[model samples]
Target: MRNDRQPDRPPLTTGAGWHRRRRGLAPWLLIGLYVVIGLAPLAITWLRGHPRQGLAHDLSSGLVMVGFAMMLMQFLLSGRFRDITGRVGADITILFHQLIAWTILAFVLLHPFLYAVPGLWPDPAQAVATLRGMFGSDALRSGGIAWWLLILLVPMAMWRDRLPIRYEIWRLSHGLGAAVIALAGLHHTLTVGTYSADPWLAGFWVVLAGLAVASLVHVYVLKPLRQFRHPYRLVSNREVADRIWEIQVEAERRPAINFAAGQFIWLNLGHSPFRLVEHPFSLSSTPADRPRLAVTVRESGDFTNRIGEIPVGTRAYVDGPYGTFTLARRRASGLAFFAGGVGLGPIIGLLRELVQEQYRGPVHLLYGNRVETQILYRDELEAMGKTLDFRLQLILSEPPEGWRGPAGELTPEVIDACLDGRFPKDWLYFVCGPVPMMESVEATLLARGVPARRIVSERFKYS
Candidate 1:
């Protein structure tokens, strides 16, 4: 590989440090709020004057109450709330959402089973009769509906890819199903719950259900309305590599959405934002270039494979500036980037920002791809090398005849060789890639003494 060097200029100053401090507090505050609200029903139940129940009965009631609270909280953690996801990153928030869903499912599943425990009631046959009455009762119809819906929803979500349904259809069904579950769960809680008979508990359920509905409206209605007012037009779309294309859009009669480097947007091209057709793509352009945003997408999915068909002047909607995978939040003596294939999208934006800001540090990149043709923005990356103390190491799993760059997977030996075994502990590291590759690289970095805080990564897909 050829080495290109350029004179470095002074780095630009900004209020990023102050912003980082403020944003850092948001996740903890949100978590605190979640814990308080989720446990509020239990706390209120304990305070209220209620008849004493056996341990199994009390435990069963407590499980369902907490489970319902968690179910309601799922609305806020849907990867749409910037206040909740701004600092933690959307991937982590969504991962938590999925994990928490399973937990709540388990709780709900156990609620009825525990009530049927023979030890809970003096007569085992009486407990069985009570269970049958609850299951067959007309008043508990909503509870039965919620119970079955939850049973179906979690497994369907887990095996969504294997289902014979389009992504958009699945999304629509998921949203509608969730709404039904929330409403049914709320009905059951207020009407059938022992503690919920209290005025305060009933009011709490009403408020949570209202918030849940509001969250859906915010995502499906209000957000699209706002996007309609500030739309973007496609400036250009061209193939950058074998299967990757660069999409550039210019805001219509407004400035582009302000976002830090390495952030992403939910891009909807030639479709209204109200539709569930948008896909998340990392911005491949720096904040320095406003009113014009770009994203590099690989032709992997159904929507992405049809990128070539998008007209040049199509109107676009962006719900964006999301994700915490940026340098603005962390300070470092140097920077290192490890990107694989299309994972270079966000890293490229960060590199451009470093160049634009004239960052004076030893910047290194270890970019891995399967073949040479898939390597994107080669010429521009080389130009960036000329503007900063940057080193680019291209790694290919398969190389052409007589190729001289590093070859094979991004193993520990390969990474050590690329950095010359000088892995800085304080330098910030950015990684974006396939899950296996990312897991391998992260383990290697941790083993090599890199602090976990110094390494930031964003997963491309959750499922």
Candidate 2:
């Protein structure tokens, strides 16, 4: 991996206000642009006396799938949409990505059936025989087999948890599967000659291919090469709790990157972000502390469990500043954070910001863990609780004997108890936790007169 990291740039700390401001104008702008471009294409067809396939169901399905694929590619490359829209949150993003992939799979299966099953179609056995006969010479025939292999491999990678597979191996398989899909689709388009037979279809293919190539360069080559130039070295690492560690990293050169609190960056230890094993982690430190970044992790998976094994002075590549949940533009009189287990990573970042800004209003923290041992940053939270205008409530699901703090999950009752009238109804709430805990907390908040607009939550997905 070459040193390809870019020099220090302005931090992308603007919050939802930026997105909201754009949102209002975006729809009208998009509508106007759509009318212009869309109508122009239709008008061209009319002027040329060509038949237009207006909005056929099959064509709509195909377009939707392609549009989603384009969005995925855009996200995997730009990292801009993810920052502006929670669409790219760790949990939400993965779910939608899987949904889109499965939807495409459905289109893949249905397109042929709808077109061929009724009439003007070869029988199954005859079609198979014909396919086999033409395999070597026909690109579409070869690609048909390739498509099946892609369909097989992608699903397997997605459900790899059910199999005896590691994340690294699954990631590699997923990438290869995508490559097979792209090549096969390209071949099929060139050979089948349905839409591809048209000059306009050729133009569309060229654009998609160009975008795909650009994304590939951004992910695999350009980004990794830049990381080589701005290598961040681990300066210190310490165990924060049982099976948890806090790592401090600093740049070795003048152009050290500064990361915004609550924003996440993809970390590459021995390999670059392009590597199959790279993972995203939120920066647990504030931007005021320049030239260094801190990330806290629990031993939840292979990569995290091995964090303790990473030697001091090891080089790392950071590929982000992505995420919408930040303290930059939030307009709340008071702030509340609910964290479950290791989900305290972003909460800690928020706390640091509050402390730095000398926020005098109420700030409440409700953190839950299985045991006292699993509670990360316990001492720091306690100290901050005493020093700032903040309240801290620690809950242990399974407390040891003689333990007197709150016990059990962060249920509605637990959240209510933690609040204890310290904050008002209009207080801003941020929750980060495992899926179940977050869902429960968010529901509880909404039930307790906290408006949906006031509650913010983040869900972390381990992939």
Off by over 4 Å in 1: 1-25, 118-126
Candidate 2 residue-wise lDDT, 271-346, digit = tens: 6545645777778887777688888888787788789989998877776666656654445556789999878998
How far residue 403's Cα lies from its native spot in candidate 1, in Å, is 1.2
The lDDT per prediction is: 0.87, 0.65
> What TM-score do all the candidates reach, one by one?
0.94, 0.81
Clashing pairs in 2: 2-228, 3-228, 3-229, 4-225, 4-226, 4-227, 4-228, 4-229, 5-226, 5-227
* Model 1 residue-pair collision total: 0
lDDT of 2: 0.65
lDDT (C-alpha) at residue 380 in model 2: 83
Q: Could you tell me the lDDT of residue 231 within candidate 2?
A: 84
Candidate 1 vs. true structure, TM-score: 0.94
Top model by TM-score, which number?
1
Error of 2 at 59 (Å): 5.9
